[model samples]
Target chain A: MKVVEIRPPYLIFLGSESRATYAKTGAGLAQWRPELCSGQLRLAADTVDLGLPDLTLEQAAEAGVGSLVIGTAAVGGGIPEDWYPVLREALSRGIDVVAGAHKRLAEVPGLSESAAAGGAQLVDVRVPPAELPVGTGKKRRGKRLLMVGTDCAVGKKYSALCLERDMRAAGMKADFRASGQTGIMIAGCGIPMDAVVSDFLSGAAEILSPDNDDDHWDVIEGQGGLFHPGYSSVSTGLLIGSQPDAFVVCHEAGRERISGWDDFPLPSIEDVIARTVELGVLVNPAIHCVGVCVNTSSLAEDERKSYLAQLEKRLVLPCVDPLIDGAEAIVRGLR
Target chain B: MKVVEIRPPYLIFLGSESRATYAKTGAGLAQWRPELCSGQLRLAADTVDLGLPDLTLEQAAEAGVGSLVIGTAAVGGGIPEDWYPVLREALSRGIDVVAGAHKRLAEVPGLSESAAAGGAQLVDVRVPPAELPVGTGKKRRGKRLLMVGTDCAVGKKYSALCLERDMRAAGMKADFRASGQTGIMIAGCGIPMDAVVSDFLSGAAEILSPDNDDDHWDVIEGQGGLFHPGYSSVSTGLLIGSQPDAFVVCHEAGRERISGWDDFPLPSIEDVIARTVELGVLVNPAIHCVGVCVNTSSLAEDERKSYLAQLEKRLVLPCVDPLIDGAEAIVRGLR
Candidate 1:
């Protein structure tokens, strides 16, 4: 496992992505850490933008961009052949190439030599740290809140980031722990839980959120859902490894099926909460659900408000779209 | 992930091991596939023996041994420096080196060159197959029975093998699906579930026990316990991927705590059954526990019978030592 440290002042690569949904990685970085991002680079004129200045390879290098981060994930996580020339040019200019794609940047033909020639590093964000220990199941000192989802891309990362912000604003000691590529690029470090060996899934999660201050709250970003047939193991491992004192169930407002797994239906917020607690207790005896965070971006304004209100009333927990309504209400429940 | 195929007529290498427990791999191979084993190789005179003819590298080569399989796992699964010379010697003799250790055999300095020079292959059994897909969670065609445990090293592998042998003897279509190194060696081919990436844990399990004939039973070997804080994720993933129609709880008699974790106590048979059903039902709605396999070797002869009888009465399920009493009773319950 490799611990990836991506250089900042990034040039976001959109790679001809027309839809904003597929370009969420670039959007997330632009939304969260605008200062670290120097500009955006797109392969096509009609591609989605992250509101950053458009820059060419030479322009990005001239502007002192330290790395070019692939912001859009392609289907199957492969690097498109068309994007190679730009990446090669960036590397030739001593700009580090950072990617979380399944195909490693260094594995691309001639990429390593090009990187060596320009004295630039090629960072693979998906690789985990080496020699991770198996989960001890020993209780850690810090207070931790993990964001669990009903399916993949159901606002777990967003909710966690929001909680960290609100918790800090509310005068609490907190740190947002990233668990995926986008979040890792935003926070500058994290273990890609999905890429870890099955035996060390929980172990890596334990390393991701090590013992901290007694009063500190580690808002750990979560991964796949417990009911997700394909990835439930990753979810279960992360949940157990995190051993969160409290967790928030993150769900999309209107989605009924698992993101890519159409054969399986999504587990309800209640189901997610119940199962998270049921399995979480194996590691943390006192684990409980703190709130619910729903992604209501697809819902109408009225429907979003009503849906959240109905959910809060039914579950007897704070429910909010962390992006829109803010996470103050959820943070209030943490106390 | 690499699908390892070890050639038979094995020379079991028990490297300076004094404890029979530490040399279980050799013991297992000798017990299950005695005809395939030509001889034993020990570094020390007093080391545990598998009752095979003790042979030197020259004698093993003369006896037509195809592989020198490392049959003892060290503290951290590393090949000891002292054993390197012997391994090199075996490779130099054109005997393939087969190891399931954490440190790859190819990574051992000068071993690859020796193997190549002698036209011998280096087999790393822990590496998984490449391009494994995420689990689809779709029910496959076949009846599968999984061996789950209350903790690590609790006879799950032994129980599964026993069931496979017993079920076959009873004129049932059954195949033992190996998930670990020793079992894989016995079965000839299997995915090392623990070595698979976290996201593909279930996928690998799916590949391990693919869709078979309706009457065929894939008795999948299980890994870590669901109650094991360090390895529950592997257990959960395997359970989901196997989608076993039936499961058998494999437990060691009087083992109160998790094998390596002194802090966490073992879950009871009832607890294991309940939770296995609870989690397993997500992938296998018809999942049920058929019987219990207890490793009662630690108990007295009279005590073992009485203990099993009392447990059978309480749990209302067939309870037997798969090794001592045979898995026939459990096989009867499976029908």
Candidate 2:
């Protein structure tokens, strides 16, 4: 239900393949709030760039950039040490910096002093909650809706956010519970599910979903996929931990394989629905799928429309490109 | 494949729970290598104890106990501070101490000094491996076998160990991969999968399962159960990370419900087998259920045989009380 209205003078640092690799994080703000985009920043050696004029850290500070974004895919590595001087310099210059790395900026020694000295903020989107207690198998109240996906970067968060917006607009009680970095930025408060201890992964979900009335709905952003080799564990954890009463399967149009995994082919959408329902029931027998959220970003105008129509016919559930149509159908299904 | 032959005189500190709870840790050594059990130790508590004598830390050292066992289950808590003084005192007297608490003994502020001064060993079983990298989801070279269960303490580890022993005895390439504290102690090296970062849960399993020929079988110990709300995440992670070609369902015979969850009626054995296979194939299409390991310790002698017979008749796959039958039939199913 919460959303950050991204302001002007955005500084997009083109490090870690910002264009194609960290495309979502690098361009999410601009895409969500295009009117607020100042420009993009790139490394001097950048071959393929975002076409915005290259701006140095000092220049960005002088320009009074509201936030310097270091949105890149550093999935398995530590924070790139190269960005340290720039982050510290920005912090000293009264400009906030938002990073979506597995490493937390707050944990960097002396970074807090720089931020405090300049009265600027440091947002590490993937930072986990302070203390995630072990889960007790006690039954909870309220309906939890988790966005399950067929692959990583398949609009799981986007679909969940849309559902929340639509749900709230319809005068329903709904809150977006973020599980990853992008969702965290919009929600303002969320535990980066992938960063916490394994034992507390599902427990994190259990703790995040508040015990509210049956009318209340917590729309949780899911991560990974049961078919994703590198991240299926996380997906499974999210599936069981969130304890969803219903799920929306998110899939990108024409995704033949997982983003990085070539050895694995995508399972049929039918299989994904069946698999999620089975996985969900394993934890909560009453849980089932409500709808399908397809990303038509890769399809053409005619193709996108036809794909949605065909999907709706085949899925036998509400199917929509959540970004375009909102998750009204899913919310309707939930009700 | 490697088993620790515990030597006596054994000093089991009944600090956490001498009998009901932590008896497993205190007496596992004797049960695994009974020839080495000299006696047990206990606090001044006059209640039901592990039947070990009341031996002080000093007496334990004087008696030349090989390892002071502090095996007690402290779910959702830290190592009891009261045991610190005893542990330090024992270390100073040249006696190795084995602790299964989630909190590592070496991390204790001054315990390392006592250990160094006494030339004693400090072994913390639940320590996760340092520097577990992210998984690539590339095809691994070996055939891995995993033992999954319906609940925590349903004998996943015990079944895996049995399978490994039987497979190796039958002239197969087999090794047991530990995923929890007890399994880690038995294996000598493994990341405490539950204690690790959430993203690395599956990654830890990927790193542990070495690349070998398809003929080799990695019998990985699974933690938690999909139905056990507290630990399903760990189970999910183990299942996805291990990427087993085949799985064995581990169940405690004559159990009416989950170990701690009185509300949940036990799912039928058929459902468990079908569910595991379904879950397994979500990650690997060829994955299937090969067998079942029944923990018949709770049943009477005659009942154990009849229950296993009924299970075999109903399940069709190999069924066994691993401790008694040595998992020979389960291994045969895999072959």
Candidate 3:
């Protein structure tokens, strides 16, 4: 029922360090509800080198893009030096700059002053929670929905955000509570849960959703998968903290193994649902899995259909590819 | 076989915060090998009122205590103000300082210069790993003995350290690998695994116990229980990173639940053994629990006798209260 207003179109800027590992972060902006922003992705290097189609910075400038989004994973180095000229150029043009990288562009020496002088917002998406409390075992009130996935980078945030938007569009009072860098960037407010202290990971979730009546819903974004070797703790913390009343098991069609982990085979969708429900019940025993949110974008049309059909057959719960079918089914299933 | 020559007798300093939650940490040094330190606990405050027996700083000074040990957990506040005067007094005396608190005593205002002037060593127990690598699932060299536990604070480090000592006493090349803050303090090296990034938690463990030949054994300390809601991630990361050839299941005699979680009931000893073995196999399938290290300190003599007898009878593996029987049976069992 509410749409952001007075915000300018975002011109996504992907520098040399933006591809391969971080390509999804850059592509997510234009791909997530394209009409929400001006359709332009500006590249620092030759446009032809990009795996995906994108425009050069000059082309974005020619189109008079209103905002700059640093849409790349920093891969630990945080804000590559090659990115400064384009970032300063964007700030000097009076364009608001938003970034999901661990490094804050605003901290690039004179960039904050440049942003201040140009009257632009300098946003760092992974800013940790200002104040987070240790999780109390006390039960909280809310119709909370969580999106868990079979692997990392499987669009749990996308599904959660989609559900939030659809619920809002249907005249329901709902909010999207982000749990990671990408989700934080999109929501404009959320803690990068992984970067938080080990004890505060779940506490971040509890603070984000808090408590609300059944009539009000909280669409909570999920983190890494439970089977992920490197980042499973973040997932476990989110699962313990959110205590969702119901959850969506998110997965990509035809994915055989956990991404980046060749040893971890993807669990059956049913197993994923069972594990999620089991974790939820630790806090709220009445909790359950309401639906399946499959990302079938990578599969061929026949492959997608067959894969979804197999998943639907296996799971008694309603299963839908949120990207293609929208999350209306999931929103309805939460009831 | 190797007693460190440079380190001198530690005069254990327990601030007012010592007795309540971090009583274990204060007591750890006193108890690790009581004879390793002088029988002196310096009180920061009043004449008596300490939850334990102790000596005054002047008395310790008269005895020529060589170093001061901050024998208390900071509980995240680091060094408390009330304890600073006593700390300054210790530093002024040219006493080498050792601590396991998250806060580094060396960095406390004027303390580093005081230490420098006094020609004393300022040691921070949990001073992170020097460099860490992502777990490559590569085969590593060494006979790793990991001490897993049924719950947190149930003596994983105690057993690991005990095994290390017992192995060395038996004329073997053994090294203790610390995982948590307290363990790091005891061993004088190793990462504070909980403070590590989620992706790097396991990686920290891998780096701490690098490749070594069969002549050497690594007795790695464990952290959090897998069933603990607040800290399971830390436990899981340690388990994966250690990839032990064999493990020892540690537990208190009367603990029936997870430490901070009232809802989480403790699994039976059999279940704990099975789960530890299962997780160990995830890293190296041939891995298993070689013995049990029970902390029967809370039990009466008759109860301890019957409980351990029942455990040893039910499970074929050797089960010993390491403090009582000295972990020699467990060390032999690792073979």
Candidate 4:
């Protein structure tokens, strides 16, 4: 709801393609104008030559722009040649650049240079991964916290943040951690206690690589995929490194059991507890809880309650509204 | 946490595999320890051969015992044979048969026959699903409701129940409903509402099945699973259904993101609003609010609050404790 305005005196960066993103330039613009940005129109239309590094560099320097906003392009495979050096050179000059969503052009190796060169920065215009709890002496308190979703736009980060707030409100010491791919991005937030499935996802972990001597609690780590290779292995490794007193699992509720292929009616609570024990850890068993975040557009309260209650009774943990009490409950579980 | 003891004259009405269940006494005994049972002594230390029949006609004729309990080996699966004769006989003879967690099963195909034959009535030991709102013919005061989850047992039921209770307490006509598996298990909780994943898991209809058929006042449906195969199909279907008045998603909080090769961060609220409009639904672009539930074992209030605040700023959803204000917020959103 807060809007910040930028005028034409600064640099403007736009993306070349629109893949899996909002076409901000089209009709959706006026209707869905960014509420965060207000009082604009200083810079009308100034297109820098992304195809030419020298031209791009000259334009940036000539403009003496303190802030640069760039649009994103399609993300896949590799990055565009001109875009790479242009971005790299810009970063080296200590400029701030905000660009549109473009993966193929930015993420490719040797294409988008890692780190802002010359102190330049890039702000991904699209949504970014959430920050994690990264600070010193931050004790993790909770039996286990779980966020449920297999797809994007399922409200996972929202759920986690809400829980973090509630846990603190309830007077608990809790830190937000990641067990999946977001771990890499989350690290920017703080040093993660452990990454549950990072190894399986092929994510590059600079802080805690699973291969270099399994003791990796000194930094952040993440989970890979739902059923990725070595996911359980990495999870076990993280568990050992951080030795979390509690656990939180992210999940999607009311969805059918997975494919009926692997462990449908998955295991009883006892089974899961047993697995935890097998890993040389003993689950409090009764301390586990599930927070069910629902798509309000699609379900009823009663329906939501029934499914969660079944889990509560079966799992021997209290089922709660994740947005409301999930974080608090996780902290409590740690207690 | 609460345990009770019940003693019976111990007449056992058998279902289809009652005899087999009784014969495989060792397995049953192994599953439930003597210490956990109500009674001090085992009825038959050496496995009794009580010779039970399957599918008998003429209720009450088969039952000649008092304080009878129904026993079955396949507790959760296919209907057993001996149950019919026992139920019919029990009912005919005016004998009440006590069964554990079989009420839902009694409504199933084969089990219905067994109950008729043994004349045995169902006494459900399991907790019942919550009740639905009574039809008042008065238009609801708040927004139409929908509850969804990432997967099964992510606290959907508990959250729904809590919401229903809160809404009713706050003076709303909101009712709980079942759309997918819960519908078959519980009745009169609410009108059946199924979101995308529920329908996909059930394969009964598309995600937005109910809305496609009818567009009326506020409705709530429970969702299950997170991105299961059925979830995508059903969600797409439901999106094509009557566009949701407002979308609310329930998920687990305090856990890391579960990544996929294809999964990415949730779309920005602006993108979501655009999509909603494209689907012909009017919506407030900002996420109404988020309810975060957390475990409060050992977390500090400041820690929780800071994290929640950070999330609120990032997701643009005013976050609250689901247990406290989730239902109330939903009702307010309706306004």
> In terms of lDDT, which candidate is strongest?
1
For model 3, residues A58-93, the per-residue Cα lDDT tens digits are: 555566666677666666747777677777766776
For model 2, how does the per-residue alpha-carbon lDDT over B249-283 read when each residue is reduced to its tens digit?
Answer: 88887787877767766777677667776666755
**Model 1 residue B61 CA deviation in Å:** 6.8
Per-residue lDDT tens digits for candidate 3, residues B285-322, read 78877899999999899998888889989998889998
Candidate 1 lDDT tens digits, B193-256: 8988999888888888888899999999999999999999999999999999999999999999
Residue B108, candidate 3: how far off, in angstroms? 2.1
What candidate 3 gets wrong by more than 4 Å, as runs, is A1-69, A72-97, A105-107, A112-122, A168-173, A277-280, B1-69, B72-97, B112-122, B169-173, B313-317
Which window of ten consecutive residues has the lowest lDDT sum in model 4 chain A?
A195-204
TM-score winner, 3 or 4: 3
Residue A110 lDDT (model 4): 41
Interface Cα RMSD, each model: 0.8, 1.9, 2.4, 18.4
Candidate 4 per-residue lDDT over residues B18-132, each given as its tens digit:
2444434222322222222121112333434343322222322343333344444354633455455445444445454444442454564444454565454454333222222
C-alpha lDDT values of all predictions: 0.90, 0.75, 0.71, 0.36
In model 2, residue pairs whose N, Cα or C atoms come closer than 3 Å (at least 3 residues apart or on different chains), thus clashing, are none
- Model 3 global lDDT (CA atoms, 0 to 1): 0.71
Tens-digit lDDT track of model 1 for A76-159: 999989988888889999999999898888889889988988889888898887887888888888988999999998888989
The DockQ assigned to candidate 4 is 0.01
Candidate number with the higher TM-score (1 or 3):
1
